[model samples]
Target chain A: GESVGLHLPTLSVQEGDNSIINCAYSNSASDYFIWYKQESGKGPQFIIDIRSNMDKRQGQRVTVLLNKTVKHLSLQIAATQPGDSAVYFCAVHNSNSGYALNFGKGTSLLVTP
Target chain B: DVKVTQSSRYLVKRTGEKVFLECVQDMDHENMFWYRQDPGLGLRLIYFSYDVKMKEKGDIPEGYSVSREKKERFSLILESASTNQTSMYLCASSLFSGAGELFFGEGSRLTVL
Candidate 1:
């Protein structure tokens, strides 16, 4: 059974601090990964994505690091702000399962003032 | 701007009732998916379609069915809704067959009493 899981259920950080969310996947053959952010009343939006071939990928204020050896993935948010407070999810592409993505239970990030 | 629109924002229905959730995408994407989001469970794929009139069952599709008569419209049908079926249903579309980024709708929250 292929599964994606998060290390933490919730994370709290100060307004200007950096935030890190961690995820672990079971399938070693999985190659593509994605990070999504969901706000209070909105659908999850894509934040960043990385392939197995790439060790890290950077977006505007976010970075995704993938360690294939450990089947671990992490999202780093620099200078986390109030608007960055949301549930972050890591998804793995399951090629065997009709190419649908398998999403891990998200980590809720709260940026306090 | 890619847009995926869900017809209903929220709905409440009694047990054994039939429910229909509609989703439409404007991107002319070849891939469309339906997933359910729950607390501590993240998102679980229910069904996905890669082409018109073609549908595939995802990880959790036992209580749900999907219809994709048209390329841009995908509908999720609950034959007889149950209390356990209450969840937030999200619809998403992607250009590729689940390998690319997915554009999601606001989501339709259904409560089965």
Candidate 2:
């Protein structure tokens, strides 16, 4: 399978270690944010989301933190496994673009045993 | 499970050829989007539709058009394919609310010669 993010930033973590991925947006008015995971040869899969009103949201083994003050978002994964290896993308909803979601250049996460 | 189905997984066309990419969502989402993904560039929106028979241009809508004749279906059309248009095309659907998370298809990889 062809890799998704060949030239984007990369993070390598050993199995069982926690991983954090960060994203920054230029729009402070962006009220919605989402995290997506895309494996090789597949489209992005929704992992989690957070609204501007909330600072943090957690899912099973995954946590999404939103810092509206700085227009930053981060995804934290606990107990990382090899299956978690993929390209992760952060999407922001831009009201100026008629509420279309704009995606960031993905971060390639490689979980090694 | 919510499924967004893309009609073609891979396609090859020559310059000046007409190309059509079909997307269907089983979740009956109100908003559907077409985006092209390239290495290091993330995903760029081509077009989107929030309702049947209605369309909106995204940040990068040139050379692309879309149709949403039915609630569950959205189509991306390239009037005349170009080599620069060759990329991994992704289709996604979300609820009407601007804050809703997007669900994406497996994607259609198109190559224009």
Candidate 3:
């Protein structure tokens, strides 16, 4: 079974600052990617997503960057808030294989006031 | 609005006891999923249903069974709960039609003593 690891690279940002959380995926054939935000005692919410054909996509206060060449994806949060503190996950899917998402080990983002 | 809701926020059961976890989705999405989250493991798929009465096994399906009699409901069952099965269980849903983003529920933390 593909399992997420406990150890994760963490990033800390002050309130009103910008935050960027990066992840490196293992499978190169993955064509779609999404970023999820999980707060304490809550389920994960969709932050942003980017397809493999594109390099970057932006949403409300969030941006997702996908680099297929490096099998890397990143989430950028603009004007980080204390409420933005969360464990962020990157999930990849291969369109050719029924599109099951393969998740990367998440990164923890701590936004300080 | 909560798109997905789990039946319990926490559960305590003795070893070898049968347990059931219920989930319901209100968005009318065709895809419903059950996943377990551990301290080190982010989220592992236990089972998923694409439609009523249809199901598929995800990355980790051992010791688990699922039932999906209706489009909006999905249930996970542990025939015999073990200490290894104690973890946070989450349910999610998503639409088909080429859009692949999942909306998750606040997890059910189960403890098997």
Candidate 4:
């Protein structure tokens, strides 16, 4: 069965600290991966994406790393802030399924002062 | 900014009632999707359309149907709303096919009594 899953259900971090969220996928055919951030009552927003052709991709304050060898993907947030507290999800796109995304259970990040 | 707009931000319905959720995208995307977000469970894809009038079933398509009458509009129909069907419904769009970054609209929180 092809599925995407997160390593942890929740993460607590202090302000100004770096945060890392992990995701694992079962589909080897997956070539494109994306990270999304969702606020309390909002939809998922794109943060960063990494293709299988590249090991890493970086956005303004976020970085996404793709390790095809282990079928792992990770999102790293630099200097986590209160505004960064949200649920983060990782999605995978396989060539076999055009336009369909397999999303992992989200990790809720809580940044405290 | 890429805009995906959902028709309703919140909705309340009774069991056995038919419900409709509409989504529109301004990016001239070829793909549109509907997903439901629930507690503990991640985003589950209900349905997606790669092109107008071409709909496909996603992982969790039971109890839901989709319509893509036009390129910019996609609609999710719940044949009979149930208490178990209450969830946060998200709509998304992507420019082309597989591996494209998805742009999501603010979700519509539906409550079925």
- Top lDDT model: 1
Rank all candidate structures by their DockQ, best first, as comma-separated numbers. 4, 1, 2, 3
Winner on lDDT between 1 and 4 is 1
Fnat scores for every prediction = 0.68, 0.70, 0.46, 0.90
Between prediction 1 and prediction 2, the one with superior TM-score is: 1
Q: Every model's Cα RMSD, please?
A: 0.9, 4.0, 2.2, 1.1
lDDT of the structure predicted as candidate 1: 0.93
Candidate 1 chain A minimal-lDDT segment of 10 residues:
A93-102
Q: Look at candidate 1 and give me any clashing residue pairs.
A: none
B12-73 per-residue lDDT for model 4 (tens digits) = 99999999999999989999999999999999889999999999998899999999999999
Candidate with maximal DockQ: 4
lDDT of 1 by residue, B1-113 (tens): 99999999999999999999999999899999999999988999999999999998888999899999999999999999999999999999999775578888999999999
Which rank order by lDDT, best down to worst?
Answer: 1, 4, 2, 3
Off by over 4 Å in 1: none
Q: Please give the CA lDDT of all the candidate structures.
A: 0.93, 0.88, 0.83, 0.92
lDDT for B57 in candidate 4 is: 93
- Which portions of model 4 show Cα errors greater than 4 Å? none
Query: In candidate 4, what are the lDDT values of residues A1-113, reduced to their tens digit?
Result: 46899999999999999999999999899989999999998889988888889999888889888999999999999999999999999999887766788889999999999
Q: Could you tell me how far off, in angstroms, the CA of residue A57 lies in candidate 3 after the best superposition?
A: 0.9
TM-score for predicted model 3 compared with the true structure: 0.92
